[model samples]
Target: MADNEQDHEHTPLLQDQDNNDNEQHNHHDQTSHRNVVENIRNLIENEIPNGHHLNSSSTPKRVHALLPRLFTLINSLVDCSNVEDEVVTDEVVEYLCSLGQEVVYGLLRCIESMVAEGQRDVGRKRLLDRRAEITQVAAAAVTKAFVDKDRMGTYCHVLSRPYYAVGEERNTAENAIEIAIRVHATDFIADIEVQRCVQALWTGLILQVEEDESRIRFVEYGGLRRSRRGLLDWFDIGRLNVPKYQNNMKIALFIFFLAMYTFVVNNQSPNPNIIEWLMYVFVCGYIFEEFRLIFEGGTAFFLGSIWHWVNIISYSMFMVSFSFRFTASYILTDKSKIVQYNDIAYDLQALLAVFLWVKTLSLLDGNQYFGTMVMVLQKMLKDGIMFFWLLAWVFIGFLQSFFALQKAETKDFNAAFSLLVRGFLQDPDWELAEVLDNKYGFWVFALYLFLTSIILLNLLIALFNSSYTNITDSSEKEYLALFTFKVFSYLKSPDQFPYAAPFNLIEVFFVIPFTPILSKENYKSLNRVVMGILFWIPVLTIAYGEQKRYEELTGTNDDDDIQGGRRRYRHLTLDDISVEDLFMIEDVDENAAAVSGETAIQIANGEEGAVVDASFTGWKSNGPVNETFADFQRRRVKENEARAKAAAAAARAEEASSSSDEDERADAAAAAAAVASSTSAGPAMSEALVQTLLASIARMEERQKEMETLLKQLNVPTAED
Candidate 1:
């Protein structure tokens, strides 16, 4: 009865506990819902001002301010585990999409920053977990904005919004790289609608500008419309003021000329053709463009770029080649002379063509793979210059020696230098000895050959190897520096011409004229007159010419034809063909088995070591057997000791021989002194002194023999013994 009473009391307690837990869970859910709504409301209020649209210039600052709050909310939603949380998150994203380009850009940048930071912080689990969702939502929002606008120009303009444009953080390379990474990670290139959009924006970044005016113009006229900003602005040509854009425009014009040159080369006619007339026009345009670049940038700026020099030399050659070709076809009446002149011109054109193509590599200096190769080659060349100087000094020494010794035969320094070069090439002529009558000539030649061939040449090889290795080691850093320089140049460039020349030239002539007229307050009628006169002719001509050409080339009647066929070519090799024509599996196995059997037989006969097993399944030892560290150390020590003993014995023998030479010289001096002193005494006294000296010399010889015997017993060989 007491146990039953206790059970009834515990059951009531359990029921009360369950009720309290349910109430707390309900309260938490309500609080979360309230927080989500409150945060969303606050974000919208902060980002959008009264009486302004989301795309208004004033909204970018407000949107920037709202980024931190949005990131906080994204973090909170990341750990959310129910359908309600997903619904709230989707609503937040919908609000984000409505706030326009700046907001969407900020949201992407925030996610990128979170991801970049998460890699370094262990406590950023929410960021890591929701990264994919965040990226997907942000990408979808950006895509929607792009579609809604229908203009890649507007989209590209939106992407140029700066995060921090007025502080030390402004123009930061890391910030740009992060933005690029975010754009690349979206895989927007796969989206057919935005492929051109992505490419134009990426090109702007590569040019190191906020936006490329040429690219913007290309997009605008190429058929994209801006909804808020209106379709056309004559004054927008002011963007062409940027130097990088001007440079790019120049490159495009050069490429066009190069294409014309290619067409002329392929024409195959001996006589002048219509293509040659077009080439004259292109050459004139190239000359004008080159001079404009030179005069605009000034002498220092023009000379500073290696590409400029390349351009100058190539154009000069092109001019000469064209002149020669013209003379050969028109003025030169003799057939043989004409052929010779034509050959010369062709050779010059070929050389110029090589240099022109090589200059194009500078355009890809921002690409990692190509840039790395260029940088490595540059470093190798820089270091090789120093090595060249050292080699030159040694070469000069040999050159002068040979020139002086074989002056009669060589006739001049050039002839002697030629001979020295032959020696360097390891083709020294022994027959030159007969021409060099002086005995000293042979010894000098030997010394020159020894120094140049054995020491200097090997040193040059070592220097080259070291330079190549060093360049390879730092290739990554060099590429990064090049990429960063490209970004920084764009960021620091002024808002100016975002297109290259010739193309930019059109804007200069046609567009700049209308800027002043459009800016005036009361010139509506005049503006219309100017627009009709300036714009319609070019626009209509381009449209009609393009349409006519398209119809002619494609043989299609449809005005809105979009389908274009790509030319395809297939390459076939042995591996691409049917296996039956080559070898069957049975035949391959038999050949492999036979080779293995032969190898096994050689190994068994001890003709060769077993480098491979008979089955050809695994490696076998052909090198020396491995030794333990301790055994290796012991062997090394014994070898060192033997070497040291040999060295010591040689040193002692050399010292003993030197001492014997000193003793012999001292004895001869003593005998001469004694004879001089005895000369004054008498003939008999001198004779007695000589006999004593002879006896002493015999005694010294006997002592020398005893010393030799002792040295032999010690196994230390003396000079004579």
Candidate 2:
């Protein structure tokens, strides 16, 4: 009935086309739709043959008349949108089956006529017979497309919402899920609300039926999304972010032993038996670990516990032992261990171990106390009582070897006194020549003590005293100064190489204090100190040598002159220059103006109150030289306020831009869709054809309703109570 209505409305257009064709050709085209229809009617009246090949022009109009009827049938099969009742939805699905193969094949033929050869296979009727299966696939594709669209919508929502714009928390997950449920329900699920509730019930039922263990381990529909690779796999060797170079205990211990040997050689002390023993022990430990790895393959527990701890123990032992002996010897001998090339070498080893311990402690975070304790020990070894012991050893070694030796040999007190008197009274050739000789340095031991007490003693005292001061303050500046001194000292004599070898376990005992502080939260502040110390040591060592060379060249003998020489050379000093002079000398104002001229000018004029741009203009400002307390405070306050305002403005602008983008996106999304009807006009209908198509659709729906009513009546029982 709907097709008949559409055919009646479109017949005039076919008649007009036939007339036009006839006028152009100057002949009546019987192949035209009007001509063909008339001819077919005439043939029926006159009893003519039935096998007539209709031309393309006439067939299309005839097909057009049949298309609306066929479109209604196909549309019903997969039309689940806005369905509120299951009975009606079922009736629609059942009514679609009544079309049978004949109508389906005809529809396929029409589609084939319009579509290209590549699409003809897809237009086949074999799959259309199982129209339900085809509908399911189409629904899945449509659902996936809608889900992607919904995700985009949610992203826009979160980006555009006023709360999000103002820095309130964004609702990303909630928005995504809400959109997914809404678009799918209205477009795909028949009796949408009821079907969705049923799906939820089915899911809950399945979950309840599952065993506890299975449920726990099963792929949950709802859970935090994780990468396919398990957590442990990421930590495996050769994976992402693993430590590239391991701190080898064997190499560190060798370096430690080398340092000890150098220390003994430089100080001209007792047997280096301790250093030899350390080397032997470290080699043994390495051999043992190598054998274990060879036989058992490496395990995590072994690596983390036994291997790492053993190295720490060895390093701590070396440091503690060295500290005890060196401190005692320096005190007794009255020699400056700080000046010795070998002592520097040994400390370098300890320093490396300390640095390694610091790094490991960082990995453990704040939870590990053992690592922190080790760091404290390292500090004590580096800057604590070692200098006192070194002083004691320097003084005591001379007394024990010389005065005590003479006292023991001299049975007469007068002879002992005379022996001491003879030492100074002796000729320069007799005393100096003997002291310079290989074996008679027993007398010269007194000279070593005297010179050390006066010269080397002060240096040792200053070195340790300054280190202690820095350790107490633990400031970046102090650490830098200490490191600078160490570097200068080392460069003055390269034989005292820092960390020349790998580290040992015992030295790590002194590195534990750093573990608690080397966390990511604390590292930024602490790292500056550590890096300053590390870099400053080398630089200061060079500076110290240069200063010493300058003093030597200038022939300076005053202790104050020596101290002044040690300081870094600069063109200007605070007391010697004014704010304006400093500005002139360094061209500070010019540089600041070049970087940000407007901001610099405002700051200089004090008109804009030092307002800075968002990109760190305030932070980069050059304030008054040697600024007074009030001036510094005022400048700082103004700069901070300007920076804060700039940052706030930038944040507001970013939010505004984001909201505008979202508004544009939402507009585009709204424009993309047209007003949808209870039933679509199918893929074959267009706006130019809407009025004729709607008349067809309305009649088809009425016919479907009548059929459903008739079918229900037929199915009803005839027997009554």
Write candidate 1's Cα lDDT for 612-665 as tens digits: 211101111111223322343454354344334433433433334345574653
lDDT per residue, candidate 2, 115-211, as tens digits? 3332455654343334333333333232232222222111122111111112323221111112222222222232222122222222211011112
Count of backbone collisions in candidate 2:
63
What's the TM-score of every candidate structure? 0.37, 0.17
Which candidate number has the best lDDT? 1
Weakest 10 consecutive residues of candidate 2 by summed lDDT? 236-245
Off by over 4 Å in 1: 1-305, 326-340, 389-397, 408-414, 422-474, 484-721
Off by over 4 Å in 2: 1-226, 229-236, 244-368, 384-386, 393-721
Q: Each model's C-alpha lDDT?
A: 0.48, 0.34
